[model samples]
Target: MAALITRTRARWFAVAAAAVTLPRAAALTARASALTRRSMLLGAGTGALAAATSAAPALARPAPSDGAWAKHDGAFAGVEFDGFKKTPSGLEYKVFEEGYGVKPTAGQGIKAHYAGYLLDGAKFDSSYDRRSPLGFAVGTGRVIKGWDEALLDMRVGEKRVLKIPAALAYGKRGVGPIPADSTLVFFVELVAITG
Candidate 1:
């Protein structure tokens, strides 16, 4: 009788110990799995939803080709203008009105009223709508690379149509109103060299 009770108590203690340890072990495993899943999501670029609002995504896109530049709608859509000039860095622009006003250099304060568009003639943003000119320091990394390069070449009051490649404009991740891997166009007018 004594031996039977001792065996029963030992068995119960073992089962209880297993029950307690099992849950802790399972909880630890779940935590580890959740951490690994989160890391994998970040590495794969399907980043955390909260982070996506602030973080610029990795450049998963390649340098742009001429396909996006195919005009979907515009008066000059089908017209191949000979005046389109290319910069060595692949920015394309055609001058509409070359003003005699001041041209900006590096670190110069400049202002412009511009309409931004995607290649499909979708307007994304415009300072013109707000009745205000956009102002920024030229060549100071304050703006996108395409904008900085364009601003440097532009004189105040000059108007031009710009075809900015994805790499120069937004890379793989575009900001608000712009889509990922997009090529952009702009009908930009240099309002003034603020400096």
Candidate 2:
């Protein structure tokens, strides 16, 4: 089941990097400095994932360089996934049937609140207690690739469930309470978007 869901998500990951990168070059014209830092952070995260892989022998494995099936199967690769629909902007997402909002975008700076949980349904991080929006640039690498992808096709006032595979997430050595090679789930709300 998890494998299926991960394969589903991996299918979207390829399109995600392209989708966000295309819009970013032009959009960052006015905010070059901030965008640069965000890009650095993202690069750092990617580097971290690579480094994490070498840390634990239990987590050591080659990743799929192409296709969602291969990516998920090797990394997070199996299980059927449901719930989100693909949009023209390249985001596959669903609004909570009981609530409302729009998809997110890469260039839009967002003020959001979120909670991160492991596949076993254990919560790792939450913004509710902080009573504040966690500000971040959507696709510039300020956050994990899963988040960068999930939040890119949204509009203001949107909420999303970001189902993340281990590759787009912590990869091998999971951060803090998250386990090595863990899959993550996030409930995120875009409270506001600012220039």
Would you list the C-alpha lDDT of every candidate in the order shown? Answer: 0.64, 0.53
* Sliding window of 10 residues with minimal summed lDDT for model 1: 59-68
* lDDT per residue (tens digit) for residues 1-195 in model 1: 999999999998877666555455445334323433212222332233224322322211111111222223442342333456899998888764445545888998887777787866687787776767788898999988988898899876566678888999999997998988887877777777778
- The alpha-carbon deviation from the true structure for residue 190 of candidate 2, after best TM-score superposition, in angstroms, is 0.9
TM agreement with the true structure for every prediction:
0.59, 0.51
List residue ranges in candidate 2 displaced over 4 A.
Answer: 1-81, 85-93, 97-107
Instruction: Evaluate residue 138 in candidate 1 and report its C-alpha lDDT on the 0 to 100 scale.
Output: 88
Local distance difference test, candidate 2: 0.53
Model 2, TM vs. native: 0.51
Worst 10 residues of 2 by lDDT: 64-73
For residues 1-195, could you state the per-residue lDDT of candidate 2 as single tens digits? 999999988987766555544244333322322222222222333344334333323311222111111111112112323535554433344442112345556676777777676756567787765666688778898888778876665555445556677778778976889888876766666667664
Each model's number of backbone clashes? 0, 17
